[model samples]
Target chain A: MTAREEILSRIRGALGDTPSRPDVPRTHRQQGVHRPGTPELVRQLIDRLEDYRATVVRVAAEDDDAIGQAIADALTVRGIGQVVAPPGVPRAWTGRLADVVVDEASIDARTLDRIPAVVTGSVVAIAETGTIVLDGATVCGRRAITLVPDTHVCVVRAMHVVQTVPEGLQRVDPRRALTFVSGPSATSDIELDRVEGVHGPRTLIVVVAG
Target chain B: MSTFLGMPGVPVRGPAADTAVGHLTGDRPFPAAARDSLADTQLRRNLAHATSTIRAKRAAVVTEVPDWEALRDAGSAIKADTMARLPELLEQLEANVVARGGTVHWARDAAEANRIVTDLVRATGADEVVKVKSMATQEIGLNEALEAVGVTAHETDLAELIVQLGHDRPSHILVPAIHRGRAEIREIFALEMPGVDPSLTDEPAVLAAAARTHLRQVFLRARVAVSGANFGVAETGTLTVVESEGNGRMCLTLPETLITVMGIEKVVPSWRDLEVFLQLLPRSSTGERMNPYTSTWTGVTPGDGPQEFHLVLLDNGRTRALADDLGRTALHCIRCSACLNVCPVYERTGGHAYGSTYPGPIGAILTPLLTGLTGGDDPNDSLPYASTLCGACYDVCPVKINIPEILVQLRAEHTEAHADRHRLPTAEAAAMKAVAWSMADPARFARAGRAAALARHGIRRGKPLLPLPPPLNGWTASRDAPRPSAESFRDWWARTRGPSS
Candidate 1:
């Protein structure tokens, strides 16, 4: 047999049809483990993120339009005009920001350099820890968009947010690339001084959608 | 290009006689140096600020989960059990990996590990290999080994690439280029990157773009990829790499041949064991609940990724480290980097001061065990005295490796190794002999204490002693000597209260 086949056989042998098993189907079983509620998890996640020195803002699900407006306002406050969005980002979200030019899909390094903020949707949010999980889907583009922009505005649907890390890990598909962002990219390497946005985004802004 | 199997052996040096010969005396004590380091204002400020922020961040997220402590306990237990059953687990892992069409090679030390990897690359006829920031490869100096054989090793991790291009050593465990600022990175890119934009500024984006352009070519072209595992699951023989950058995915998937060189300490008993480490590692090292990317693969995946796979299980003195009852806990390190984050000495002197790929608290313990103190004036010997035994490393270690305890143990070993060279003189020995004689008897101790009190009265009021004579000079160099009381506490109590009436 091939190496791959042999590896599978060994894994099966090692597992040995153990009697104890999880309740849910194996694929779905990983994602839906015990987690905190959306609102509570979001609050805890934001609090922890702030401890990491990440800038956080809370918005209600009813204020989905306001989430977009907040991104535009943050950009204006930072004195930047251009914003980048992933291809699948809701048009309603970007349509609300009139003053800022919303650039979508074709956001390469050169283009991202011109953009001041990137607002995207999250794959999942772990409320227990206040971490935003991004797969290469919807508002979260390839890892580059969130990393390249100075400020990242991640919109989390309340329903998608989970309470714990284990629950969050289960939901994420291992085959596809995923990025778990807790706060802005930071380092304390130089004389042990905490510096933000060294290689990744210097500022991380979380928009919690109800 | 020549393979590692056919290359000449490179001698390794220990830390003692390498750079610290002048500072240390025959006493084998770091009392003076340790005291002086405490007074360094800049270092204190830097460490206090850095550690506090990460501490606060880690605590906030960690406390969010009710199971956080349980996870940490589980992670520690799993690593302990794995270390205990390493021989059997490794054999099982090797058999499983081999069955999956992947090759398994056992390397005894850095030289052998290097030779195996270099030979594999040569056999593949690949001149360049794209690497995903594997510390094991760095520890073994695989890039330099590959370079000697005319094969180039390209580091795809942005921080590692910066470290490589700058000709600098990694200063931080997670962020290797933490010592360098953007301005310095811009300068390196300008000087080193072949097609770097001439007008590139020191802006983070500009620097990142330059690196992206430079490495993109290598990622697409390189046929061989080398990596190190965060954990190796024994049950399924699966290897996991947890990273923030997506570059690891590219390197793992795009390359035709994937070779992973993992230290024996990385094994976990089962996939369930990963649950504990996955929770502990990210929170401790990067201050995240979970990392951005965690990739796990077993053997090979038909047409999806690398066609050929190899796992090189590296011992390189790990077994020797495990043999020591007090020191075996050092092997339990997950390389989460929490100890490095909190170490006061590492924060100031930086990673280069340790002079090994493994730096900071883990380095202090592991380097000496791996390289030993016997080799020709080796630099690894001084690593034991590099810490102040502050116990900060022990507090943050997820596996609860008693770093301070191991440091003391290593210090004792170092003294024994150089006992003849560091022997006390006849006069000093005789003085100590007299003191020991007096200290052993309670009546003599009381008499000495009374004499000390009498001596205190004669000490000049305005002028305090700055330097003590000979043996005590080390203590006086960095701190003030406390004034002795004019009367002993016992005598004062006796006089004030009339014999306990």
Candidate 2:
């Protein structure tokens, strides 16, 4: 017999008169927050993002120019002269930045390594865990765009923020590779101290644009 | 290029366990190994700092959820239900993986898993592969096996990189190099990591920066990658890896091919069950609300991540452990490492003393059960006695595995199993039997009690003779023995109530 058969048969033998499984009591709270329609949820999102050391700027205006200015200011402060922005993002945002490297072709890892930053729009942001989920859509690009660069400046519309993981997951397209990022790349591997910037993004700036 | 790992199919059962989990022997027994570890003041300080910090963080996040207990119950129940239907779920997983453009291999033991991975790398003709820190790979000693075939596996996770560079075995599950301080890490990197920054400092960010620069180059160059799954959804053939660093992302994405070796118990019934584990794991392991990255991929995506994926389902000793209801709870472990952090005994001894790839509270009972404790000299038989029956492990266990209860049960099994191997009565058995027989009769108990009172005459200056004799000397070797009371409690009560009652 093959290993698969042997393994399965041993498992079956061990479970002699396999009793019916008890019903799962999934009574755990699934919502991200207790109170619905509270402004605290959005505040909680910013609070958590800041706690994890991600730069959060809320842009209340719906104007593309206003969102563009906010994105420019974040880049100027950090001296990031170049960035890779995928298609489908408002051109006004990338148009304002210096040396904006928007290529029509897919970016390779070596090229991505040379780029200083990446600008993309996320599918949803979870407030409870301070996570940003990218669905690799036209706006999100592929996983490599967000991952291979030193900085990730994600644009999250106010409407895109959800109160909990379950709420954020509802908007996820499971077919696409899903990268749920809580903050800039970090490691507590050395004595459990939180050290940011390890291989992914060193700086994660979120423009909470409307 | 070499098939030094044996024939590249299924491994036979002889020493099958040696393949599944790593080595079965520590250089010495727990006490002997722990003595050396405890004496290292620097290691103690490192462990104390790290475990306490993580412990506080776990407690803080765990308290945030009002339904934490319910979540724990749900997590435990889901794993239990998965185990009951594991064989069926595995078959379903295989079918789904094949349907979704992924190949699945089954390994009965560790040697086969290693062989399968070695061949896959050779098939791609990649001499070096990048790696995500995975307990399953560590358990099977995959890197060493790969090296025997002339393949170099570059560990990308910061902690794993530290262990790999230092040429050290892991001292903790989550933080593999937890025993080393910052200065030691800098020293390791300076000596081992090629092209490391010459001015590396002990400050964590500087050290992390140095590692990042070194490993990012490796990540970009490697053609193959290997990993272990946090959870595999059988319904969709989706594999999830939760990590704090993006190294896992690099390994999972940048490589041309990805091979993941997962234990059969890692399969969940459905994707929705992630609500429970994803919630429980980060809080329990790192004390974070959520880790930085949680990457999920189903089989292969055409223009994305790795186009070729292989899932090796491993079952070295899981089937044996699952055979017993009492023992199988150990298998429910999610590799969270929470039990190790809070265990008082583990706090002192560190991971190496347990003599298995898995160590700490879980390893104490798990090692013996997996090996079946077939002989008196089994190295793991010494493990079950390593614990102090402190229920701290169970109290903090997210899955609510009753570790203390299992420790006690295994201790009984070990003593019973080892009895026949002894030609002469062992001291422990003789002592227990004497105590049991003496307590069985009231008259004999009184006689024994009077004799104990008479033993007080042997005391001088309120202390027993320094080197008494045989059994008495064993008790006095480490501690001063207390003098017996002139009057036994039974004697005091009996004189007054003897005739009246």
Candidate 3:
């Protein structure tokens, strides 16, 4: 028999003729906010993002220029001159940068790595867990653009912030590849000590625009 | 393999050698191996420090949530429900994955899984593949298998990289280099890591930076990446990897071909279920509100990540573990290693003593469940006895595995296994039978008790309980076998008052 058939038969035989299907009681905190990214939720999201050592700066809810200026300021403060911005990210954001590379298909992995930073828009942010979700949309860019660079400056609009993981899940497209950033890349591998920045971007500056 | 009790994976009675499979069984019995680790003071200090530090962090984070218990109950129930319909869910997972332009392969055992992976890596024509830290891959000895076939697998996780560079076995699940101090880690990187700076310091941040520099080029150049899934969603064909570092993202993103060796038990029923697990896992494992990065991908995202995605569903010895009713809960573990941090036994002897890729309280039950205990000379037979029966493991278990109860059950199974192989019962079993016989009648009970009181003449009540004769010494090895009382309770009662009519 094929391995699949054999394994299935084994599970069936193991469970026996009548298997008990226990009820999954999901009484846990599933939904905290019915609406995505309210003002209150955005404040909580900033608290969480800041707690993880990520720089969170807020702007007026619909001020596109202010969002761009905030992103530029975060990058400039870090002395990062060049950045690769994915398509669909507001051009005004990278317009102030010294060198801006569009996250196009032609940007090879090696070249992407050479670029010091990446700026992209996020799909959603979870306030409770301090997480930012990036679906592989044009706004979020491809997974490689965000990963290969040393610095990631992600802009999460206030409306994109959710109160809980369930809320974050509701906003994401499951078919699209998703990256959840709670903080910059970190490891507690050495003596269980939390050291931020390993392999992924060292600096994660969250631009929480209105 | 012959079926026992109509279960295809269940081995028949007698010395069932087929059950002794994979890296699940350790090189030596746990007691003998623990003796070596116990002697290493460095290991003891490292284990003590790391476990205590993580324990505090876990406790602090866990208390922040009001519905922690409710979440754990839901986590446990979800796992139970998934296991009950594993075959159906697995089929659903396969169908969904295949529908998304991804290929799925089934392996009945470790050997087959190794062959499947080796062949896939060969097909890519890559001499080396970068890896994300995965327990399933470690359990199957994937690295060694790849090396034998001329494929070097570079471990990308800092801890795994440390273990790989040092040519050492992982001592902890979450922190593979938990046993190695920063000094030793610095030395390993300086020597093993090509192009590393000569003056590398023992500081964690410095060590981390060195590893980043060492692996950056490798991650960019790698053609194939292999990973293990924390959760595989059957609903959307999505596989999630919860990691603190970005190595997981690098491997999941940059590679042209990505292969994930996921245990068949990893598949949950739906995408929404991740909400519960994502909340439970990071807090329980790393004591963080959330891990730094969690990447979830469906099969083959065009122009985004790996275009060629292969999810190899591994059944190495999981079906054997599922064959028993009470034992099947061992499979519910999310590889969080929460139980390990709180386990008193693991804190002292360290992970190497457990012998398997999985160590501590979970390994004590999981290894034996995956690979059945052969009564005579099997190292796994000693695993169930490696615990102090402290329910700390069960208490901290995110999925509520009841590891202490399983340990007790496995001990009984071990005794039965031994009894089946020998004509004479084990010494403990024989002693138990003798006591049962002695207590049957009142007159006989008195005589047996009076005979036991004779030991008071030579042995004192409060004396240390070792250096006994061969069979009795086994009990004293871990426990304080009390001396027989000078006067029996019955005799004392008779003298003080009157014996019950």
Most accurate candidate by TM-score: 3
lDDT of each: 0.67, 0.84, 0.87
For residue B422, give model 1's deviation from the true position in Å: 4.8
Cα deviation at B157, candidate 1, in Å, is: 2.1
For model 2, the superposed segments whose C-alpha errors exceed 4 Å read A33-38, A101-105, B1-16, B19-21, B459-463, B466-475, B479-482
Candidate 1 per-residue lDDT, tens place, B199-282, comes to 799776567667766776676577899999888777777778887655676677667899999987788777666656777888
Put the candidates in TM-score order, highest first: 3, 2, 1
Residues A56-92, candidate 1, lDDT per residue (tens digit)? 7666653657777766666667776666777777776
State the lDDT of candidate 3 residue by residue for A111-147, as single tens digits: 9988999999988899888999998898899989998
Candidate 1 ranges beyond 4 A from true positions: A1-162, A168-210, B1-53, B373-378, B420-435, B454-467, B489-501
Ordering by DockQ:
3, 2, 1
Better of 1 and 3 by TM-score: 3
Range of the 10 consecutive residues with the lowest summed lDDT in candidate 3 chain B:
B11-20
Clashing pairs in 2: A32-A164, B19-B110
Residue A45 displacement (Å), model 3: 1.8
Q: Pick the candidate with the highest DockQ.
A: 3
Q: Name the 10 consecutive residues with the lowest summed lDDT in model 1 chain B.
A: B15-24
Model 3 ranges with Cα > 4 A deviation: A33-35, B1-22, B464-467, B476-481
Which of the predicted structures, 1 or 2, would earn the higher TM-score when compared with the native? 2
